[model samples]
Target: MELPRHYNENRLVLMVQEPTIIFSYWELSRGQWESLGDERFLVLRLYTTGSNRVSTVLKEVSLPPFTNDWYFRNVLPEHTYHAELGYYGPEGEFYPLLRSNKVVTPRTRPVEGMVRFLKVKTVILDTTNKDTAEEQGDSNAFWGGYSSMDLVHRS
Candidate 1:
């Protein structure tokens, strides 16, 4: 997928800060891959509720530079939650680009009025198990593991 025009000049980072979950079928360009370092990787933060699960399946095998693509599925009992997506750089931070509240009926497309933007800083990842952290050590693994991303948003 093509990245939004605004993100072209900005740097993008993605992190899975939620507890025990797996992300599959996602690929990043050499540039995007290199943009993320240990300290900077904390810029992209996503969270989930107790016992909730989040999963991503890539539809495309390869992606080009300046591309923003996401395919996600969630399984939760009966609670609404927010999922934040955005880019973090020296300039500042952005988020709430998308949000969803659990309803009685299932949703196929993102619910309207569910998207917004917020300037945020410092994201935390609380995990349920140690194995999740161990798996994250193997970056080469097809399914990437979990990690925390703390964004420091500027005014």
Candidate 2:
């Protein structure tokens, strides 16, 4: 089996592997590569979008111009993320060459105060059966009651 050198498209992809890490891959088409001048350094940037929908760069790695993939670690859980292939301009500017799909990281833990269901059994003790309970030598009789239920029907 053979794989083509590049996808021949200018696109990027970002995905979450678990709660704290994300991976990205990209391919720049011929035109996209030629469009980048030598004025700035190429970079792969990982961003996290906050609740206000503002994207903040989490990490930026210098690219070797032909680099295709990278991994971002120590990311915060439940954060929206995306990747951008761009140039770090001389005047504190970012020239985005291509953008990746957006995704949200999974939470690391269960939500607090969430409802949970558990199986339970109720047992009633018979205080009147203490002598029989003592004869059985069961530890449950320590409370001076048999570990048996006696239901009294209200009806």
Candidate 3:
């Protein structure tokens, strides 16, 4: 089946490819495409929200002319992100054309143990385990001193 390049509609979409990357695509209507003046250029702004629910711009990427898709990398697991398609006005003011839906990256197994896993034995520990951390509090009950390699071999 053949698909048209674009639907000629102004739209933006953001999708999480995994726990650390995002894929985004956008389309501009004919009128929106012509709206870029001589001094204006296209740009995509990636925003991330923290626990406070406040959004901040993480990265601003300059897009080549007539581009449609972008890939964002190095995003933290379990983080919220969104994107905005816009252009800078002649005076350096931002005028957004479209806003994408918010997305949260899935938490991975390794991130749960990054702090503890990077320790002496490369053991991955779940920091949020309240039950194990409460029993005697010796920090050995959760996985029984299993390093990441041990888990790999056992499984």
Q: What's the lDDT for all of these models?
A: 0.36, 0.77, 0.84
State which candidate has the highest lDDT: 3
Backbone clashes (count) for model 3: 0
| Predicted model with the maximum TM-score | 3
TM-score per candidate, in order?
A: 0.21, 0.65, 0.68
C-alpha positional error of residue 155 in candidate 2 after TM-score superposition, expressed in Å? 36
Compared to the true structure, candidate 2 yields what TM-score?
0.65
Is 1 or 3 the stronger prediction by TM-score? 3
- Residue 87 Cα positional deviation in candidate 1, in Å, after optimal superposition: 1.7
* Candidate 2 lDDT over residue span 85-124, tens digit each: 8886778888888889999999988767534344333333
Clashing pairs in 1: 42-149, 121-151, 121-153, 122-151, 123-150, 123-151
Tens-digit lDDT string for candidate 3 (10-70): 9999999989999999998988877775666789999999999899999999999768999
lDDT (tens digit, per residue) of candidate 1 on 1-155: 97653433333333222322223222334564466644342222334444435633221122234445443344332333333433356666442222323222134355564344453333333474535433455443344322222222321
Q: Point out where model 2 deviates above 4 Å.
A: 37-40, 111-155
